[model samples]
Target: MSIAEERIDRLHTLAKQAVAAREFDRSREYVRLARRIAERNRCGLPREFKRFSCPRCDVYLRPGVNARVRTQDGHVVVTCDCGELKRYPYQS
Candidate 1:
């Protein structure tokens, strides 16, 4: 894989572990890093996408465009612009 891809993969993995361990703060940081990598690599996501929503509508504040941030601790929930914050289970 390309360097960007590799970085993204690593970041995702770390985030996942952190989430599973309940390290929300760490997971958030990793997610933010992953999002930066995705943005730098021009992931080709839809323009109107804007952000990602949690599957459960508990928390809707992700660091990337429609990104699923995760770690070993658990998942960081996100609120959807749809008016409800949701919780989504994800893997880093």
Candidate 2:
């Protein structure tokens, strides 16, 4: 992987750790930095990274903590505390 991709992966790990430690603001900063790096390098964020982060508030979502997860029809719904909702299709 490229240097930017590596850095984004590291940032993703750090953001998850920050959220687990309850340092939500730090996690948000990490997410924001990762996104900026991706934008500058003209690359897209990883699918796992994108799924675990709130696009509207840049917060790292922890299901049952800052995010609610539900399955509706053929898709999974993730609702962030900031009221942002994301849906991803599932095989079921």
Candidate 3:
């Protein structure tokens, strides 16, 4: 992987860890940094990273904590505490 990709992955891990430790602001900072790096390098964020972050609030989401997860008819819905809703389609 490229250096930027590696750094993004590392930041993803750090963000998860920070959230797990209840250091929310630190996790948000990590998410923002990773996004800035991706934008500067002209690359997309990883699927997992994108799924776990809130686009509106820049918060790392942990289901049952800051996020609510529900499965609808054709898609999975993730509702962030900031009231941002993301729907991802799935085949079941």
State the lDDT of candidate 1 residue by residue for 1-92, as single tens digits.
67877786676667656656656667667666666777889873222222441323322244443333434456655444344544545566
Relative to the true structure, candidate 1 reaches a TM of 0.49
* Candidate that beats the other on lDDT, 1 or 3, i.e. the better one: 3
For every candidate, C-alpha RMSD to the true structure in Å: 10.6, 0.7, 0.6
Greater-TM-score candidate between 1 and 3: 3
lDDT of each: 0.52, 0.97, 0.96
The candidate that wins on lDDT is 2
Give per-model TM-scores. Answer: 0.49, 0.97, 0.97
Candidate 3, position 14, lDDT = 96
Clash tally for model 3:
0
Q: What lDDT is obtained when candidate 1 is compared to the true structure?
A: 0.52
Candidate 2: where is the Cα deviation over 4 Å?
none
